[model samples]
Target: MTKIPAISLRRLSKSFGDLDVLGVMDLDVGRGEFVSILGPSGCGKSTLLSILSGIEEATTGEITIHGAPLNQSGQPFAWMPQNDALLPWRTVVDNVGLGYQVAGRLSKRAARDQARLLLPAFGLEEFSRALPYQLSGGMRQRVALARTIAQGRDMLLLDEPFGALDAITRTELQLWLEQIWGVDRPTVILITHDVREAVLLSDRIYVFSDRPAQIVAEFEVPLDRPRTIEMLAGAQATQLELDLLRALHVGSGDTP
Candidate 1:
């Protein structure tokens, strides 16, 4: 028998009054799969993430995870938005443990303890007591990631988690994220504008058209993981990147 998808969106659409953002979208993210939704900025990509996370409701259609209605179920999905959104006054450990405290119903100390165990993996062990302002942008993102994982969620919804970092830092975090996901594959739906980032991290990629957005094409990343930036320089990965780029361009009515 076929395994149920980790996430399923059917004929989903969203609008703000007269302005439609997503128009009749459908998507499936399989169990333990890493999928990326790549599109140009302001194409309702982040809006889609918000809708799936229940931060925003779809105007029409349904969202399900594991065959259960997403909003109706006590869905255990973690959402990490573009900004790290860390509390400035909180120490790293406290910030990283916040989600665990709320979702896992652990005491503050217990939450900190649990989060501490994950700090080293996310490269924040040394800064556990440091404030968010004391850390770099990338470090803050790591803490946010650790916090998301602390919730013990099986699905991760990342909205350009590394989008604001410097190029080198973003690349490093992408590799780190892959290593974590490789070991314990949680279903991931990453929204990103970077084609190369999508190619490097995703098992499959869905390219979306401009506003009133919908998927225009999908590509399977042919490279095997433990994928590396070096692998992205190879012919197959390059071609995939070019193909995605061309698809985005064409979807936006630009000549490739």
Candidate 2:
């Protein structure tokens, strides 16, 4: 028997009044797979994530998780938006545990204890008691990521999680994320505009057309697991980057 996909969308579309954000689209994410959605700005990449996370309702279509209908009550995904969005007043640990506290799934103390255990993995152990204001941008993103991971959800919807950082920091976090994903293997759908970022991290990539977005191309990255920075500089990876960049231009209707 075939394995059920972790998430599936058929004819999924979204609109706001007179504006259409996403056209009819069909997509699937396999269990523990890392998929990236590449598109131009305002091309409905974030809108797709909003719909999947239940923050926005779809205009039309079917959505399924593990072959069953979506269950909004279950809160099946952990989402990390472009900005770190950490609460400045809260300590790193508190912010990390905020999800559990808000969901009433654990007592404040229990939540902090659980979050504390995850801080070391994200390199935030020493800063557990530090406020968000005290940390650098990269560190703040790590805390936000730790919070997302603390939820223990099976799916991660990352909407440009590393987009705001400087190039060096972003690359560091990318490698860090690869290591984490290798260990935990949660199903992931990342939204990014960076061709190299997509090429570096995704198991598969789907390029979307400009506004009122629809997938225009898809490519599978056959690179080996435990992907490293060195691998990204190889001939195969360079070619893949160029291919994805070409697709992005095509999707945007630019001469490539």
Candidate 3:
């Protein structure tokens, strides 16, 4: 069966002032599938994301989510940025619920009640009363994911949510994120500079070229579901990673 695409981009293109930032990009994301966009810096990965999230406009293209066009203001989708963006003064529980509070969508009591419900899942029930400053980096990212998950949106646009973590923490969180997303099955488009990280998590990866970014290659990740670091040593995963590194070389300029 042809799975319904959660997001569809047809002939997408974008430009900044006089410079072309993205051009004639085409993409499709099936419902509940996790896809990653990998590329070098200045390839408009962020710009493309801005358009997908409706944070920025598309110069020429179409974006459809669940078969409907996305209007400005980026509704029906939640975006988690590279930074957790938590307020230090707020309690962990309070920070998670801040989304509803700022939107005036729920009363403080209701919001906290809802946010409190997620504490156990992220393993932060004990730290609910603590402030952001009191939590470790991994814990802070948990709070960020908890906040995004709390929104109950069907699509998640994750822009290097784990990039700032140390190697050990990053690997641990990769497993954690895979568990959550696999269980919930929300359509996800992750943007990351770490090619290895992208290889470990995505169903498929879209490789982009520089400045006027466009898709140069797309590779299907053949590693089976519930992926683990142990697979990191497996032949299939290694081959896919090598192929992706090669894909980045398709464009002009320095690439590794």
In what order do the candidates fall by TM-score, top score first?
1, 2, 3
Judge candidate 1 against the unseen true structure and give its global Cα lDDT, from 0 to 1.
Answer: 0.91
| lDDT digits (tens) for residues 1-256 of candidate 3 | 4765788899989987899999798899988789999988767888877877778999998888777787743586788877899988899999898766654378878989988988898889999999998899999999999888877777888988888999999998999998888887888999887888998899989998877988888988989889888987899988988888888876535654
RMSD of each: 1.1, 1.3, 1.9
Q: Report every candidate's CA lDDT.
A: 0.91, 0.91, 0.85
The C-alpha TM-scores of every prediction are: 0.97, 0.97, 0.94
Q: Cα deviation of 12 in candidate 2 (Å)?
A: 0.6
- TM-score-better candidate, 2 vs 3: 2
- Tell me which of candidates 1 and 2 scores higher on TM-score: 1
Global Cα lDDT for candidate 2: 0.91
Estimate candidate 3's alpha-carbon lDDT, on a 0 to 1 scale.
0.85
How many backbone clashes does every candidate have? Answer: 0, 0, 0
lDDT of 3 at 138: 94
